[model samples]
Target: MGKKNVSGWSTIIMLLTAAALFTGCSASAGSKPSAELHEKTMHWDKMPEMTIDLDKSYTAKFTTSMGDFTVKLYAEDSPITVNNFVFLAKQGFYDGLTFHRIMETFMIQGGDPKGNGTGTPGYSIPDELDTELKYEPGIVAMANTGKPNSGGSQFFISTGKDSENLNQMPNYTIFGKVTEGMDTVLAIAKTPVKETKPIEPVIIEKVVIVQS
Candidate 1:
């Protein structure tokens, strides 16, 4: 009787082990691919040809390591900036890029190909600033070198409501705003950082453009 009991317990243990292995394999197969698997970064000789229809409304959905956020593009108000952004988003230029700068309670900046403060898309676009737009929280704007017509691929999203400081320096082009998932943007803003850079990488996994 004792021998039979021992044999039954051994069978139970083997079945449990097999189940665990199968679960592990399934999870591994279904998981999203790591950022390293994507090779979408490339330099363009000039700005991409404008293909966005001004009449249609557009939005960009960014999938990141922390979470997802959606930005509504102000195409009519900032056509050039919106067009360039849309082109890059469709081309997958922003994928796998890290959010290099983070100013707590202020903003989070990304879209730099170099994953640092000094990368551009091999070209620059003229600033498309509107006097009416305010640099309030959830506002998305282009990052530039504090020079005229120096706007490029880098962009930032405002996380704080206090814009008296940004309003004073009114250079970042206001092309979009976070229409959904501001929580994700704030979450990223709260990431631990050193020297204004996130200690651990917060990658832009992908950016999907939606036109209506």
Candidate 2:
């Protein structure tokens, strides 16, 4: 839960510094992967317990109603997440998705099928916690509940200032942060919420990869 409007002055100095620190939490989508289509295409039981392949960087744009937000990933810093996100993104898994939950000052969490905040990509990644990064505002990280390695498809985008005590927790790998469209993020966060769910769903219509 958060209070008041969370405002962050986008200092050019801070932006440069932030670019040096963030890692890959991951993202997905290109084609419309229908629920029925995915069920037939992917086999949960046969899928490798750990199917993420690192050694790559992924850039994708989030096409939302508010605007488009782009994210860049770092596999070197968060290998497990990088692999996972790339795999899912290539599979077009995040299409037609909703940003299920959006809190005010606190981070907005998504990627759950339950919409109660307890869904995953059918597996979890080990924590790739590094001492360099903290839960700074605009910093993106995975959202986990129990244990250190229980993270999967869920993630959160920070709202206000840096988190005061999140760095103390072990695991919970941070994979990426917002590169542009912080205003859109703030607008999304400011959307009304009830019981942790947004009053008007912020749908990610599609994701497009932007090559360098």
Q: Which candidate is the best by lDDT?
A: 1
**What residue pairs clash in candidate 1, if any at all?**
none
Best by TM-score: 1
TM for candidate 2 is 0.72
Note the Cα lDDT for every prediction shown: 0.75, 0.60
Q: What is the C-alpha local distance difference test score of candidate 1?
A: 0.75
Per-residue CA lDDT of model 1 for 60-148, tens digit only, reads: 99999999999999998899999999998888899888787887667788887766455667778888775478788998888776567
State the TM-score for model 1.
0.79
Residue 97, candidate 2: alpha-carbon lDDT: 63
Q: What is the lDDT of residue 180 in candidate 2?
A: 85
Q: After superposition, how far is residue 10 of candidate 2 from its true place, in Å?
A: 25
- As a whole number from 0 to 100, the lDDT of residue 140 in candidate 1 is 88
Candidate 1 shows a clash count of: 0
User: Backbone clashes per model, in order?
Assistant: 0, 4
